[model samples]
Target: MRRFTRNAAVAAAAAVAALGLTVTQASATSLDTWTVTPGGSFTATATNPTLTVPAATLECASSSASGTLDTGSGNPGAGIGTITTLSFTDCSVIGIDFDVTTAGSMPLNVNGVSSVANAVDGSITNIDAHVEGTACSADFTGQVTGYYKNDTKQLVINDGNLTASNADCLGVINDDDPALYEAVYAVSGGHTITLD
Candidate 1:
């Protein structure tokens, strides 16, 4: 009787395992995969944008930035990509050196095909900015508006703006009051992104 019970238990366990395998295989066929190629070189810029701070508002006369896209994969409708090689130049912030750069890839939502009206919004963190040899960092929220030109294989970031506030701009300005010590930044520019 003991031997018979042990054999029955083993058979039941094997049946359950077979059922699980069949369910997993059925679900796997229903799943869809999407592959996104690198859209090539991308660039964004801002010009003479206003930055409002707790103490005062600062205006940058000229600011420009650029980056590139990385290869990605996801579902067909819900895919994502990243921006790499981000660099900023010719930025002029009042009382602060306009030297800024991104530390990591900026994420972008990937729709079926690249469209001009598609909404691409993300945040850039660990930004490195320098003022009079003093190094500081802050996070920036960016909104990019543009279209993907299939003819030219380029992604255009036109009339885009990036804003960051509540940043501690130490040694950039002389203020005794702590409330007036914070600084804000705004940059605007239009750039063309090349997709290969």
Candidate 2:
């Protein structure tokens, strides 16, 4: 009887996977494939983007990023695209002007499609951001989780995945402090990216 039950469970799991279902952390309802329409190079902008850590908050009046995606149908895998440039303008940390930039790794991925129509979940990996202020400074590195909507053309991020490293901020922002980058970027450019 034990052997029979175990084999049945394995068969059930295999059946689910054969349906092209992405039953990972994303969502059980999310399909395992993605379709990017009119894909290519694109640019995005966000207003009032903010990065909050246990020690301090870095807020910006505006932020901009540019990247590209493949044009056509494909599976949601790593390295879907790349964010070549990302910058934050008119930023301040604790009321002090700060210069913030994203560097190192920049890959866009589509990990899952939410049950909701036109919504896709993914992340930007290897995110390295340096914050420099007159009285505070720190470097954070990690990935940012976000969901992109086709109708709104927005990528929303509000997760604490970045870890502070090489801290030198006079205790304003310490090392190993988890940082949350929250923003809603209105994506636009040559490609009208859409998922199917």
Candidate 3:
């Protein structure tokens, strides 16, 4: 097996926008505060997330899943809550990151891929969080990293800094080799990405 690494700063910036996150400081006093919100239609982000596999297995459409899958923010009020969905059409690369502060450890199934429910990708770092009352708050203290490849049927995550607290209903929709969506990081503000 080989390893692929990208600049954390660059990837973070890209992934944030790709997922339709509105990066903003909590207030004037905050130096590095940011918030992620879902954007337009066709675009998909996370609020209430869900994952399901047909029967109990996921079959790859092609022989290889070693390419990159670009991500974008999904439309809001889709009745799917605040969950981001990564659709897969071609056997491309796919990875997912959750807002540690907003969404906490939620169940995940990578279909034919390996287990990542309790595993964090190594590519992600710099996460900070503190529990307040019954709620947990987190800051994007570090990068969120992971990888999803279909050829090897594997998903990798390596982060302890990020956090998520999704207690809402987990929604999972299945499609025959569906389209995979990844988080987006805005370039010089924003750009347009079509899933099809």
lDDT of 2 by residue, 7-69 (tens): 999999899886545446355424445567777888999999998988778899999998888
Question: In model 1, how many backbone clashes occur?
Answer: 6
10 residues in a row with least lDDT, candidate 3 = 75-84
Number of the top-ranking candidate, with TM-score as the measure: 2
What ranges in model 2 sit over 4 Å off?
A: 1-31, 115-117, 190-196
Q: Per-candidate TM vs. native?
A: 0.37, 0.80, 0.19
What tens-digit string does per-residue lDDT give for candidate 3 at 39-58? Answer: 22222222222221222211
Residues 152-173 of candidate 1: C-alpha lDDT, one tens digit per residue: 4334443334454435556333
Give the alpha-carbon lDDT of every model.
0.42, 0.80, 0.26
133, model 2: CA deviation in Å? 1.1
User: Which candidate number would show the highest lDDT if scored against the true structure?
Assistant: 2
Q: Could you tell me how far off, in angstroms, the CA of residue 135 lies in candidate 2 after the best superposition?
A: 3.4
Error of 1 at 187 (Å): 21
Candidate 3 global TM-score: 0.19
Cα error, candidate 2, residue 196 (Å) = 6.2
Comparison by TM-score, 1 against 3, better one = 1
Better of 1 and 2 by lDDT: 2
Looking at model 1, the pairs that clash are 45-188, 45-189, 46-188, 46-189, 47-188, 116-147
